[model samples]
Target: MKFFDELKARGIIDALSNEEELEKKFNEGGMSFYCGYDPTARSLQLGNLFTIITCMRFQKAGHKPYMLVGGATGMIGDPSGKSEERNLLDMETLKENIDAIRKQLGLFVDFECGDNAAVLVNNADWWQGLGFLEFLRTIGKRFRVNEMLNKDSVKSRIESDSGISLTEFSYQVLQAYDFVTLNKLHNVSLQIGGSDQWGNMTAGTDLTRKMNQNQVYCMTMPLVTDQNGKKFGKSAGNAVFLDGSMTSPYKMYQFLLNQDDAIIDALLKYYTFLSLDEIAELDSKTKNEPHLRLAQKSLAQEVTKLVHGQEGLDAALRATQFFFGEKIENVSDADVASIFEDTPSVELSSEMLNEGGVIDMLSETPLFKSKKEVRRAIDQKGIYINNVAIEGPTQTLSKADLASETALVLRKGKKNYCVVKFK
Candidate 1:
């Protein structure tokens, strides 16, 4: 399929400026394209994943892709889609962030290849050297204040209690200047971003045409959300970071694997490059056995492999198996620790285990409702240690019960697993 056609099929084409003209330019082949990333944080979130992948796809289709890290504009945060003004980053912090982002981008695309070789750019390179008066004369004069006030990003903030700042209000003009710079220096013809960027992206296209009388393309991908309409890419109030240090590979794997059934199809379409035939088969399998969650697993595998690589993907799969699969009894303590590294854990003193009964530990540690409940569970043979059933009614804990001299795995039922670490 043609690249744009594929984009539409995958539901990645949320908006495009002058579709026919853009298609004509794309047909010319070897066109230049660019995507921007703001260094608002130390690491990019999963929300940034699809856009970076889109840039890679453009390169694969024989177009040059330039990845722009917003070093200059990042210091002055974009007011687009914001409810309040963002604090500006210091120049030193922004430079460090830019370098970190560039390293992360290198893992996905190559830079040594010719023609369609991927390029890394920092907008500060140009934005820093320009005199304030000169910028106003050249780029600033092209944009009208009334025209800027009408964009949705600006209007929403204006209508709210948390008003926009002048610095953030000028974001569209700065972004437009990014497009103009890329077009002039690299011959880039297209700019792509999330749906939130529609107004700013169009501004870039308009500025390029008016300033140099040249045609450019603009496209955006829709916002991703869960079945209940909650946004994706966040875990427990924090964003799921692409960097392993920020978010572990195991956690990233689980994020995709646990996707709600309603959102899996859309996610598969946007994230994976699975062939149409393969996707159809997966879809059929899903319809036939929704409970099996085959499609969700496939989506998780493909995405995990793409972002974290094979080793990371394997660790994630191992984690899944240890958590939900059979043969838990055969697993090692080290493996269990690896899988449940970030989970809530309790620490108990060895002396307490030796002097106190199982009931006392269960009640005192808040693992059970009461001593009576603990007795009932024990009577039903539901209490287990390291997947082995306990036989003694007067079971007294000892150092030997601790796994690896410091930890004990508690299994209250088939699914509930807890760990007690010795201090």
Candidate 2:
């Protein structure tokens, strides 16, 4: 399929400037395109993955992808989607964030693919040297104050309690200059970003045209959200980060796997490269047998494998299976710790276990309300020690019951599990 056609098919292109000219340029091939990522944090979150995927799609189509880390702009945050001003990061923190983000981008895009190898550029390289007066004369002169005031980002902030700052108000000018610089340095003519970045992106195209007297292109993908309209990249008020250190592969898998059925089709389009036929099949399964969660599992697997590789996906699957009645004997200690990281846990001294049977131990922890509740659950065949049903209150955790040498899995029922770590 043609590049634009594929983008439309995948629901990646929300809006683009001068589609006819861009299509012609794309058909000719070897077009260098870029998407900017601000290092506001140490790692890119799930929210940033769509743009990265878009870059990958362009690269696969034989276009050169430039992943721009916004070291210059990140210092003065983009006010695109925020209701309030962002706290500026110190230079040291911004540099650390840039280095970390650079490493994460390396995992997704090929940096050594011969001719079309992806390139990483820091906007700081050029912006750092440019003087304020020079910037005002050269780039800032192109932007009209009235036009900047009319932009959605600027207009909304101007009407709000916390009005926009001069630093942030001039952010569009800096971003526009980025496109101009890339065009001059790398022959890059296309810029892609999220729908929220439409104004900033078009400003870049405008600046390029005004400066070089040459037309450029800009495209944006829709912002992805869950069924309830919350953005897809967050869980329990925290971002689901792409860096494993920030958010573990198992947690990432579970987050995707537990998405509402109503949004799975859209997520399939936005997140995965699964073809229309495959996604259609999964959609059909979702309709016919929602209980199977075929779509959710596929979404989780595809995203997890993409971000964390096969081994990480395997670990996620193993961790998930272990909780759903799978035997715990084969799982490693590290796997056990990872799987139950969010589940309730109780730590007991080795000497404490010697003083009590299973019921007595259960009573001591928050797992059970009382000794009576423990006995009741045990009698009802709802209590399990390491996936084996505890027959009576007489049953005690023996050393052999420990999955590792130090831990035991306790289950009150099918879904509820707690880890008892013997210190």
Candidate 3:
């Protein structure tokens, strides 16, 4: 299939400039495209992964990707999606962030695919030593203040209580200049970003036209949201960090696994490389047999494998199975912590591990609440430790009761679980 048709079929195209010409360029299949990221965070989050996957699609279609890290722009925040202004980072921090992002970008796109390889770029390389006054006179003079004021990003900020700062207002000029620079240096003709960036991205295309008489294309993927119309990702209050140390594979998998049934088809298309036909089948299963959660599992597995690796997916699957009551013996501390990071936890001294009984230990936490509750749960066979049903309520905790190095799982009923940690 042609690239544009696949993009349309997958529902990936939110907005783009010059649809006919861009489609022609996509069909011709040898143009260079670019996606820019400002190092606002040391690690990219789930929202950024959507664009990365889109770049993967482009690369698979025989196009080159220029992954641009905005070291220069990170120093002055983009106010496109913000009500309040962004906190600017210093040079040292920006350098560290750019380096980290450069490394993370490697995990997604191929930096060495021969002629079609991805190129990691830092805009600071070009923007650093340019004379501020000269740039303002040459490039800044091209933008009309009326058009700048009319941008949704700028208009909203201007009408706000804080108002927009001069620094942020100039962000578009910097971003626009990036396009012209890339077009001159690398023959990059297309730019892709999230829907929120429509204003800033189009600014690049227009600036490219006005400055050098070159036509560049811009495309955006819609900012994904759930059924309730709340803006998704970090804005939805369920932010997942792309860095493994920040968010574990099990957590990322679980996050995708809990999507609403109504949005699975859209999410599978956006997050996974699955064909529309495959997503349609999953969507059918989701509607017919919601209980099996086959669609959700596939979404989780494909995304986790892409972000993390097959090994990470395997670990996540084992952790998921362990959560669902499959016995996992000799569980390590990292697995327990990562798997149960959000589970309610209570810390007790090592003395409790030796002297305290299960009833006493569980009673200390909000889970069991009281000795009577623990005793009742025990009597009813509703209590489990490390997924194993206890023999009786009379036994005390010992070193052997520890599922990992310093923690043991406590449960009341099937779903209620607490991680009891010993110092």
- The candidate that wins on lDDT is 3
lDDT of 2 by residue, 180-262 (tens): 99999999989998888899988898989999887789988898876667764532254789987667789899989999999
Instruction: Supply the global lDDT for candidate 3.
Output: 0.88
The clash numbers for all candidates, in the given order, read 0, 0, 0
Where is model 1 more than 4 Å wrong at Cα?
Answer: 233-238, 325-344, 349-364, 369-380, 386-408
Total clashing pairs in model 3: 0
Instruction: Report the candidate with higher TM-score, 1 versus 2.
Output: 2
Global lDDT scores for all candidate models? 0.80, 0.86, 0.88
Lowest lDDT 10-residue stretch of candidate 3: 229-238
Flag clash pairs in model 1.
none
Ranking by TM-score: 3, 2, 1
For residues 291-401, write the lDDT of model 1, one tens digit per residue. 999989998899888888998788778667655533344344565575666655687777765655777666554457788888898999888765567775688777667
RMSD of each: 3.5, 2.5, 2.0
TM-scores of the candidates in the order shown: 0.87, 0.92, 0.94
**Candidate structures ordered by lDDT, highest first:** 3, 2, 1
* Superposed Cα deviation of residue 214, candidate 1 (Å): 2.4
